[model samples]
Target: MKILLDFVPLVLFFIAYKLYGIYAGTAVLMGATVVQMAIIYFMDKKLSAMHKATLALILIFGALTLILKDDRFIKWKPTVLYAAMAVALAVALWGFGKNFLKMMLGNQITLPENVWVRLNTIWVVYCLFMAAINGYVAAYYSTDAWASFKLWGYVFPLAFIIGQGFYVARHIVDDTDKPAEPPGDVQ
Candidate 1:
């Protein structure tokens, strides 16, 4: 279920683009985003891990991009969101010496403070890199090309990241009642 949910963004975008070019797909993507948000909103009481607000914001901005019929909006959406996230993570680590990421996934795994800090930095930079890569493909490639990359380009890297994260978590997990460290925070 988590894996499928992870692919929601790319899956919806691809289906949208295939059914209706960029414009129509943009609208469909926006609509689907709203539906996803609605699901989270209604399920919040039942589901503990869902992020409703993020889904809502995505739908809102995605809809605006579609209604305005400007490709730039869709293109910039992920770029800005991701880049801003990277900067925020970097700032948090540098200024506060806190590990926000650990907070998010700390319950699931145990890690040390220093390790969490390093992982946070790496993941944040990775997101920024993804944002840059998204922008580059959108600019140089066709819509189909970009859409395909969005759906497929991430598969291997994501697989690696998850595998690595789990591996690290399992290794660092303490058996006794030790305090958890922060993780690399992400949306």
Candidate 2:
């Protein structure tokens, strides 16, 4: 259900672009994103920082696209968002000595500190690559081509996530296999 909600706005944007154009697609994307956020908030009673950032970007870039009658702003939105994420991850990992990715996932998955650092590095590199590729496509391609890329480009993140899953799988603790401690024993 959450995954479906996440894709709703992107799917709507693609369909609207195919049927109408960039402007209509932008408007639909904005509305769909707002609806998605509202649903998430109502269901979860809160929003993650990532969700808020994405919502803010869509609103800002979508409004610019609509008001200025220019699609470039909307086209650049993904690149900007990705770049910002890359920077944030880099800063948190290096400057602040924090592995945010690990901080978020550590409770659920147990891995060595080194593994977490490697994971954080992978995320930073992935985000930078995504941002660069998106900017390149948006700058070098036609609007129609860019629109197609926007839809098809989802493969990148999907592939990245699958790869990450594989990498993390090897490190996930199998608590079931551990010997049970004596009842009421403290350690």
Error of 1 at 158 (Å): 2.1
Q: Say what the RMSD of model 1 is.
A: 8.2
Against the true structure, candidate 2 reaches a TM-score of: 0.92
lDDT of the candidates, in the order given: 0.71, 0.93
TM values, all candidates = 0.78, 0.92
Worst 10-residue stretch by lDDT in candidate 2?
1-10
126: Cα error in model 1, Å = 0.8
Cα lDDT, model 2, residue 48? 82
Q: Alpha-carbon error at 171 in model 2, in Å?
A: 0.4
Residue-wise lDDT of candidate 1 within 1-187, one digit each (tens)? Answer: 6456556756877887888787777776776666665665576544333244345556666767777877766766666667867777788788887666877778877777777887887878787887898889878887778778777887755775886667576658665766677888878
List runs of model 2 lying over 4 Å from the truth.
176-187
**Cα-based RMSD of the predictions, in order?**
8.2, 2.4
